[model samples]
Target: MKVIVTDEISEKGLELLQKDPRIEMDVRLGLSKPELYEAIGAYDAIITRSGTQVDAELLSHATNLKMVARAGVGIDNVDVAAASEKGIIVVNAPFGNTNSAAEHTMAILLSLCRNVPGANSSLKSGEWQRAPFTGYELKHKTLGVIGLGKVGGRVARRARSFEMDVVVYDPYISEKRATDFGTRLVDLDELVQIADVITVHTPLNDETRDLITAEHFAKMKDGVLIVNCARGGIINEEAMLNALNSGKVVGAAFDVWSEEPPQGDVIRQLIEHPRMIVTPHLGANTFEAQTNVAVDVSKEILNLLDGRPVENAVNIPRFDPDLMAQMGPFMELARVLGDFISQLAPENPGKVSFQYNGKLAAYDCMPITVAGLAALLDRCTDQEVNMVNANLVADRRGLVVEQGRSTESEFFSNLITL
Candidate 1:
């Protein structure tokens, strides 16, 4: 099997692939679109970050490609639907940079609170202005966390250690989880109104796109500090600017932007703003995170090649030859049943129930349930719905899923009713 690393991957992951006698690896960076199009057909697997776009056009040419691994969380750069239709597996390292991103968020938040950027520049310029560079303590301040997943959970723990009161608003996470993390669970409105510092750690989706808009800004406390280590556009740039100008937001730190390598008037203005601290999307830029993601995604690619179950596949089923053979036509029937049930469900289903009958009960029905859930929720959420987080993603949208089995069937030996 041949593998291509088109983007800069950690040397450690490359070494792993090199040591495998069954696989041949190539590092082909800085390839133009036409060059990638021409060469992709020869490789069986490809690994990339955000630079290379694996679209329908590219996948169409990649006749021999069996898998594409993204060494990071987002797959916005890949044409997932096309890859699925082509029977190509797509994998990503969703947990590789959890610590790195959480730490970066804390770093930026601290910098904003203490005016570190301003102080550093002033000292470098040979000015000793301690009064103007006065810092604020995090103790007793309310910290609002937008998303309470991996990174957000870490941030909440760290903030609590600093004696800061943490309030979280993640519809997906249970109130018990938030309480366990030493955070008070609150609604978006409450968080916005009371928090002294607000941090975002959610994916970019339709519901979250420009989530913190002008109206939201208007509701926030004056002099509230804002941090975004998640995707761009979660906080509306225009609204932030207006808030900054109007003295509603005292300081803001942004690592991601709505646009990469931001250009034109808005970006220029934001970067030049004295109260705003911006980095060029450095949330997952640490050496440790990069290497971890490389190794993680490489392992997933190898798993796919070896016909083993892939853990972080961004699609349903994961295309297991042995499992598919055993399941036979029942798999197809289950999927169709799931589809039928999902269509009859409400616009935002609160729960999904899957009942298995007869011989289907003998086989493990977890994969079937996941496939059904993915098919159902994919129609709702903007983010890619896959087996990895289908149930969790459903829970995020206030949906619950239950699966049951029985040894009774009417027509087929095994039956799946959703």
Candidate 2:
């Protein structure tokens, strides 16, 4: 199979793909939009970073493209919905940069607290100004961690080693998880009010975007420090600058920004501020991170070529590898049954439910349900409905989809009923 590398990746990763006898990999960088669209049709798979925009127009030209492998965690640049419609699998290395990001957070947080950057610049410029550069210690400080996922959890552990009290504010995490991490779970309002240092590690979405706004900052302790290494829009840039100016925030350490290559006055003012520490989104820029992400996506591509289930597909449902062979027959059966049932059912059957019976109910049944859903909705929608776009189409059509599992099945050893 032919694979193309449209963007730069670690040599280690390129070597891995090159060494595979069954695959032929090509690296073509700085290709214009028209050139990329034309050349993409020849490759079965593509490996790229954020530079390549895998959108609908490009995908339209990629007639033979099977997979899009992103070397990094974020898939924002890639139009996932568009890829899904074309039955192209999109994958990314989500865990490869966990340590790098967590470490960067600590680096900036320490640098901000100790005024390391300013002091280093001062001494290098031939001045030994010690008193002005002197800053506070992390010990005995209350650290409020927002979001206790992989990176945040690691940050909490590292902060504990510095003798800092770690408190978390993730509604999804269990109480047991908080206790296991040795961090107290608190509400967002409480965390902002009590934390001497606050760091955000949440995904930027409707709920989390502008999460730390002027209102939230107003509740913070005087001279409270802030750190954001996750995403750009999680914190309000305008409010952050105002806080820094008013001295309500002692300092802020940011690795990511609302706009990468940040523009305008609010972002510029934050970076130029005396007490703020900024890096140009370098959380995942470490040598090790680059190699790790490359290796991860390469291995996933190999898995797909071997007809194995993809672990990190953005648009596909993942099933346990061991159970895949056993589930394959049922999946096809599910789809055929859905097609047959839809023909008999009345018009506007408001809710469609997939019921898994017998031994199959013991494991994950979502994939089977999705397969059935695709066939059932195929005639109802204008689009070519498949497992990849079934859920999205169902939502758009205002159809309620549900699933159930039951161990008791008198008819057969395994069954997928809709």
Candidate 3:
């Protein structure tokens, strides 16, 4: 199997692929977008970090691409839904850089609080600026944590060590978990209003993008510090800039930007602002993180070539091999029925439901339902719909997907209804 490494990755991680006799690995850097698209047809898989934009356009050109391996945690650069529709599996190393990102978040927060850059610059320029660079102490301060996942959890622990009271806002986690982490569970509104320091650690998804807007900033206390070392656009960059200017936010540190390579006038002005500290997306820049992430994806690629289950797939779910065998043959049949339903239903057909009975209902019927959904979307939308992304596409289009199963069939030993 042939694999293309489009972005720069650690040599330590690529060694696994390099030594493998079954895999053909190529490092082709600085390929133009068109070049990448045109050349991708020959490769079975591609590996990337954050630099490459793996969207539908690129997937269309990758006629033979079976998989996409993201070397790091974020798949923000990769259009996962598109790849899934194309029958391409997407995987990522979600855990490899946990410490690196968490540490960076705290590092930037401290830098912002202490005016480290300005103080260092002043001292180097021959000046004593002890009073001007006076900073806030973490002790007794309320630290509000947003999305207490891997990185946020670590940051909270570190803040607790500083004697800072930590409040977490993660609806996904239980209040018990928050207490274990030395944090009190709070809502976004309460966190914003009370926290002396606020840090975001959520992924950049539809729900989280621009999560902390101008309204949230308005609710903040004066001189409240903010930090965003997670995904960009989560805190609303423009709103942050406005808050910095208006003194609604006394100091802010951001390691990631809405646009990488930090473009636009607002970002430039934010960078120039004395109260704001910025870094070029270096959240996962640690040597250990780079190697760990690379090794993770490399192992997955090897897993694919070795006929082992790719465990970290973002698009495809892990299923028992035996169960897949039962559902595999029905995919075509389910798809045909879905196609029929697509043509038979009205333009604004509200919701879709699937029923499985008898033998079919005995097994997990999710794959068959998804296959039908893919066909349903094939005619209704321009997106390339397949079993992998059918349910996702259905949800995004506001086409509710519902399913039911029964042990007995009305007329046949096994039956599927759409």
TM-score for each predicted model, relative to the true structure: 0.80, 0.88, 0.81
Model 3 score (lDDT): 0.89
Candidate RMSDs in Å, in order, are: 8.2, 3.2, 5.7
lDDT of 2 at 247: 95
370-399 in candidate 1: lDDT tens per residue? Answer: 777877777676766655557667766888
Residue 302 Cα positional deviation in candidate 3, in Å, after optimal superposition: 1.8
lDDT by residue (1-418, candidate 2, tens digit) is 8999988899886677889999998889999999998899999999998789899999999888888999988787788888987778899998899999999999999999999999999999999899998799999999999999989999999999999999999999998999999999999999999999999998777688899999999999999999999999899999999999999998999988878778888899999998889998899899999999999999988988897667788898757667788887888898899899879877777789888889889988888888888899887766677777888888877889989999999989876667
Task: State how far residue 90 of model 3 sits from its true place (Å).
Answer: 0.9
Candidate 3 stretches greater than 4 Å from native:
319-418
> Residue 173 lDDT in model 3?
99
> What is the per-residue lDDT of model 3 for residues 1-418, given as tens digits with 9 covering 90 to 100?
9999999999998899999988899999999998998899999999999999999999999988988999998999999877876778899998899999999988998888788999999999999879999898889999999999999999999999989999999999999999999999999999999999999999999999999999999999999999998998998888999999899999999888888887799989998998889899899999999999999999998877876556678776444556655666676688899999899998877799998889878877776787788888889987676656777777778888889999898799888889
**Global CA lDDT of candidate 2, please?**
0.90
Candidate numbers sorted by TM-score from highest down: 2, 3, 1
lDDT by candidate, in order shown:
0.86, 0.90, 0.89
